[model samples]
Target: MKSRHIKAQITSFCFILPALTVLALLLLYPVVTSVFYSFTSKHLIKADYEFVFFKNYIAVLTDPDFWTSFLTNIKWTITSLFFQIVVGFLAALAVDRIRKGKSFFRTILIIPWAFPSIVIALSWKWILNGVSGFLPNILVKMGIVDTVPQFLSSANLAFPVLVMINVWFGAPLIMVNVLSALQTVPRDQYEAAQVDGASPLQSFLHITLPHIRIVMGLLIVLRTIWIFNSFDMIYLITGGGPAGLTQTVPIYAYNVGWGLKMLGRSSAVTVLLLIFLLMVCMLYFRILNKWEKEA
Candidate 1:
């Protein structure tokens, strides 16, 4: 009997071994290599590398450009995340209140979320092109402005425009998730609240918000990491141009590794990014635990 049980366990392990191997190759390999490379004098073109201890880290930490990109990354993540949550939550509430065509409306609204990031970035880039883009031409034709607005090139407008585009792309995901969470809420609770002379706002605050709070917290944590580490949208649309106003840490790291051939320094930047994000996630999970206990 014991031999049979051991065989069963071994078979189960064998069944999952392939998936485990792939996961390690995909996820763990890059992380381990990056960490190893960060402590060495690795170059993009050079095949030879040597241990440099903390030199790469010190160089990255002292660079003014790195700090500037870090600041922009923070602002970008916070603003984009704030709007995404607000827009998504409000949209989910509106969809929930409606009785007819719920499926159609949800489908239409989530269309943006269905597209690949590359598609979204390229489509927005064309739409916001300075010379001949649809939005600029339409605005000019309507006398909204005398000149075509350089949405991607203008320093003042570039960051905000990117934020707007991010919100549009990200909000739909939040909306779908929030909507699902909203549905999980017990209808009987709302009905009970109504019988006790509670207003809609009162019931929503006391009941609706609590039940969905955990889901929203988890969504925020995921979105925060995603937006902070975002690369493609900014890279494709603006290329972190117009006096580097829209440059984020990922872009900075890309320029360092690919442009300057400083792979070691770039790896250091990524390591720092990982550490910061992990800390942020830890704080978030702590809050989530507190909320769960209260719930």
Candidate 2:
């Protein structure tokens, strides 16, 4: 019997070994290579390279552009995450209350999240374009402004507009996840609260919040990392233009590696991002663990 059990275990490991190998190649290999290159004088196109021993890290840390992009990344992550959670949670609540056509409404609500990032970015770009755009032309016809709104160009409006677009794109995902978590909360608890004469707000504060808190916490952590590392939407829409007002760390790294051909410095920038995000995730997981204990 013991020999049979050992054979079963070996068979299971054999089944998963190929997946593990692929994972290591796809994820670990690039990460290890990036870390190794970060300490060297690697260039994007040049063949000659040598160890620089932290010079790349120092250069990236001292550059003012890097700091600016870091700050912009923080703001972008926080604002986009805040709105995504609120709007998503509210929408989930609204949809959950619907007695009829719940599936239809849920499907319609998640349509924004169904498209690829490229599609979303290009669609929004055309809609908000300064000339010959639907939204700008409609606003002008309505006499909202004398001139067409440069939603993606004006420095003041660019960051906020991107945040709004991100929220629109991301909230639906939050809604779907939160809605699933909401379904798992037993209906008896709410019914008991109602029988005890609890107000809707009171029941929500006492019961609903606790039940979905962990899911929301996990969502926040994942979304924070994703939004911070996000490149496609902003790159496709604005290309981090208008005086670099919308530039984030990923774009900064791209500019360093591709535009300036400083692969070593770009690797250093990515390493720093990895360190920061790991720290953030650690903090989030600590809080999540505490919540789990409380539960």
TM-score to native of every candidate shown: 0.97, 0.97
Tens digits of per-residue lDDT for model 1, 1-295: 9999999999999999999999899889999999999999999998999999999999999999999999999999999999999999999999999999889999999998888889988898899988779999999999999999999888789999999999999999999999999999999999999999999999999999999999999999999999999998999888898789999999999999999999998999999999999999999999999999988
Among these predictions, the greatest lDDT belongs to: 1
Cα-lDDT of candidate 1: 0.95
Encode model 2's per-residue lDDT on 1-295: one tens digit a residue.
9999999999999999999999999999999999999999999999999999989999999999999999999999999999999999999998999899999999898999888989998899899989988999999999998899999999799999999999999999999999999998899999999999999999999999999999999988999999999999988888888799999999999999999999999999999999999999999999999999999
State the weakest 10-residue window (summed lDDT) of model 2. 233-242
Q: For each candidate in turn, give its C-alpha RMSD to the true structure in angstroms.
A: 1.2, 1.3
